[model samples]
Target: MDKTTIICRCEEISYEEVEEVIEHGGRTFDDVKRLTRCGMGPCQAKICTGLVANIIHEHTALPLSEIPLQRMRMPLSPIKLEILATNSTAFSAVKSVLDEVEIEDGKVR
Candidate 1:
């Protein structure tokens, strides 16, 4: 593959950048991501995840099965903290839940 070829258009990540991360002790997809920001784009890795995985496999010779899946996070959209704090209904709902879930000795009580 061309070193200049763009793998993640959203983040402007290239094949060479991914390989660089791998050469610098990036053995997993998450490692490459944290190092190169390859999969942390607007698309949320929907496009470049497979490509990154392939690169990792090619560089490290690790089996595809050993490659850990990317962590699935909640709130796909960026939430505005100001809006969440100012919204009385949402705040009250979260506060009520927290109030009920009492923590004792690092366990919910």
Candidate 2:
């Protein structure tokens, strides 16, 4: 295996590491991402989402659709609470936009 297979280029994960996670019963995209950090990069899985899905599917019996993609709507990655607190303007804008929306029994409409 190449020392640098570039699984998650933003996070510097390797392909071998992701495969190892799949080999160890990682049947879902989230499972693999959590265990191997493949889809949790700066590109926010846009760069490696399909690839990671294929890798996990190749090692498991589950179908591709069964594994839901990670949340990609907004605020993509984990940000510190403090950081979020500091970005009041951006947070307020996002909050206002989100607040204007309504959810009817879990369905956005």
Candidate 3:
């Protein structure tokens, strides 16, 4: 694989960068992330973790189960600001947002 090829598009991390990290003893996905910021993005490792794990495996000969997953913080998935900025215990917040827009003639109005 080309070293210039991007492995983690979220953080703009490249194959060479990840490979370097592994060469220097980065054995886990988290280790590569800490050193290269590979998975810290809007996707939150959802897209890159598996790919990074493969790199780690190739370099260290470690099994997939032996390679630990990266640490995740709150907002595991993307959340709209509206969901958190407003209270909706008494109503269907998500449904209300969808209810506001009406579709007609293949157009949103």
Q: Each model's TM-score, in the order given?
A: 0.71, 0.60, 0.71
Give the lDDT ranking, best first.
3, 1, 2
Candidate 2 lDDT, 43-85, residue by residue in tens: 7787887877776776675688887776565566667778877
lDDT of each: 0.81, 0.73, 0.84
Please give the RMSD to the true structure for each candidate, in Å. 5.4, 6.1, 14.1
Clash pairs, model 3 backbone? none
Go through the candidates in order and give the clash count of each: 0, 0, 0
> Best by lDDT, which number?
3
lDDT of 1: 0.81
lDDT of 3 by residue, 11-79 (tens): 899999999999998898888888988888888889899999998888889999999877765557878
Give the TM-score (vs. native) of candidate 2. Answer: 0.60
Model 3: lDDT to the true structure: 0.84
